[model samples]
Structures are given as structure tokens and as C-alpha cells.
Target: MSATEHATCLAIAAARAAADKKAEHLAAIDVSERLGLTDVFLLASGANDRHVHAIVDAVDEAMHRAGAKRRTREGFADAHWVLVDYGDVVVHVLQNEDREFYSLERLWKDCPAIELPADLAHGGSRDGDSLGGRETTAS
Candidate 1:
């Protein structure tokens, strides 16, 4: 089975929250078939600990607002890789280097990605904005 409607909604909310905080490399994997523990895995990365914390806070708040209870939260102290489990959706906020090293996307490559909103498909605003939240232009 794939992600439930509720789970998809939660993931979308979490992704949007992450994006609003200028998170990068946002992706959502449907892990229901691979891992029954959760339906979706939402991944995002930040430049540093402070950025990671901000993304995490936004994700947590959004998920809660979406009616998902906090199941478990880990790695907030270091902010190297914060994992928030909300039963149906799990949000992962990681530092850029750590994210590259761990490569959660590579590990979950077999799963299909959730089609994020157009704005978040590439981690943030698509109208000439970089994934790092900086405006860019054709150079």
C-alpha cells in the first residue's frame, strides 16, 4: 500500500514548513511499502545547526497543526540530524554535509517520491530562487 491521504497531507504540510524556514533538498519518499512503521519520510537539510533547528521547529509546529501527534523526536540537541516521528509522517532535518554523507535519498531510491507542490518540488520558491533560499538569475 501507498501513503494514506492523511499521511500525504501531513507530509505536504511538513515540507511547506521546512521550505518556509529556508530548508534545502526537500524530498518525500513513500516508505509504506518498504517500512511499515511510517507511511512517508520527508527529508530536508539546513546549512547549519541553527538552520536545522529552525526547520525542525517549523516542521513540528506544522505537523501538530495538521493533527498528527508527536510520536518521538530525536537528535535535536546536536541538530546534525533531527528526526521527528508523527506516526504517519516523519520529518528529517539534517545539516548539509551530514545529509550528503548519510544520503537517505540514495538509500530510499527505490521508493517513489511524493509529488510536492510546485514551489517546494525543488526545496523552495521556483521563481528564480535557489534551493538555499537565495534569489538567482540566469548567469
Candidate 2:
């Protein structure tokens, strides 16, 4: 299975919002086959706490604009690793150090990449970005 069309669109919207907030790193993985909870995981990194907050806010707003009702938003108090969960797509806005330490991509290395917009790709590339066997395209 792959990420659904709606989930991919939501992920792209969230990714662009993260980019607007200057998220240092951005990636979206299709975890549909690997997990049952959500179809996509949109990962982003911010330089620090403030950056994380801004990214989270922007992502939340974008998701809402895209008509994604957030199920829950965690880790906002500390801003170390904020997770915005929409039923189909989960957005992770994290601090640079925390993002590196967790390295979620490595854990889900087998998942496919959800092709994102060119404008949203930023930061240095990681081995995990293309670790997936395929790249899923979306509208």
C-alpha cells in the first residue's frame, strides 16, 4: 500500500508551511504499509525552540487551511519535538539536535518517499530521504 491522495496533499501543504517558517530539513515518508495509524509522516527541523514553534504554528495553520482537522498536537510546551497529528498525516516539527538524535527516517527506512514540491525541499540531504525503494507522487 501507499499513502493516499488526501494524505499526500496534506503532507505537501504542511511541508510548504514548514519551509515558509525556515525549517532546516524537510521530508515526507509514506508509512502506509508500515503503520496503520497514519499514511504519511511529514518531518521537519528547526534551528531552535522558537523556530520549532513557528514551524508548528505554520504547519497547523496550513493543515487547517487544507481542511485537515488535527487530532492532537504534542510536545508544544518544550518545543523540542512537536508532533501535529491529523488522522491521515502526522507532522513532526523538531529542534535540529533532537531531529538528528532521533533520526526517525532510519527507523522507517523501508517506507517510500512522498514526492514533495521543489520549493519545499531545503537543508542538506540525508541518506534517509531516498532510502525508500520508491517515490510516490501526489497532486
Candidate 3:
């Protein structure tokens, strides 16, 4: 299935919010050309439970403001990993320990990374280096 630009933009906004919350290993995967369920997979890691929760909240709020509704959310209470399903995109907010243990990046290595815009990648600024971000627009 293919995702519209609006969906992708909203996903990017969500990813930015996660990064603003200081989530580690932040990355977005453009799976639209290859996957049936969603267009992008935004993954981020928090240092601990509280940070994980905060990241999730920030993303959710930003997405909601962007008119994206979450279809499902899991693992909030434990905060080891929180999966926020936003129909066209799926966001995985994980704790540092859980992220290392799960290593979703390795699992989805075949999928190319989603590259954010210069300003967004650097959190509204363009000074920092790329945070392992990548993307594949529709062919």
C-alpha cells in the first residue's frame, strides 16, 4: 500500500517530537513500497521508563495536532517499549535497554531508512549530524 504525503509528513512530525524528547537511536523507515500495513516506521529509544512515556506523549500530542489519530498503543504502563499505531504509520518508542535487546533496526535492516528534512533531522536546526535517519519516497 502507498501512503500519501500528508501521512508521511505527520510521521515526520512525530519522529521530530520523539527526538526533541531526547530519544536515542531515532530513525524512520519508509516501508510503503514494500509493506502492506503502513508507510513509515518511526523508531526511537528513551533512557528509562519515564522518558519513554514522555516521548510517546510528545509524539502522540504532535500527531494529534496534525490530525492523525492513533489506532492502538501498547506497553505504556511498563514503558520498556511503547508502540503507537497511527494507521498510516507505526511509532515504536522504546527504553534504551529494551531497544538494545530488541534491535528492531536489525530486524528491518532490509528496509531503507527514512531521511528527514535537514531542519527536522536536527530538531528545527541544521547543526547536528544525521541521526541514522533514512527514507525512500515513492518510485
Per-residue CA lDDT of model 1 for 1-139, tens digit only, reads: 9999999989889988988998877878899999979999998889899999999999888887888899899999999999999998988888978876787876787787787776774444343322223211112
Question: Can you write out model 3's per-residue Cα lDDT over 14-92, one digit (the tens) per residue?
Answer: 9778778876666777778778888888887777899899999999999999899989999999999899999888999
As for candidate 1, its clashing pairs are: none
Give the poorly placed runs of model 3, Cα more than 4 Å off.
1-3, 118-139
Sequence-dependent TM-score of model 2: 0.89
Order of models, best lDDT first: 2, 1, 3
Of 1 and 2, which scores higher on TM-score? 2
For each candidate, the alpha-carbon lDDT, in order, equals: 0.81, 0.82, 0.75
Residue 21's lDDT in candidate 1: 92
Report, for all candidates in order, the number of backbone clashes. Answer: 0, 0, 6
Off by over 4 Å in 1: 121-139
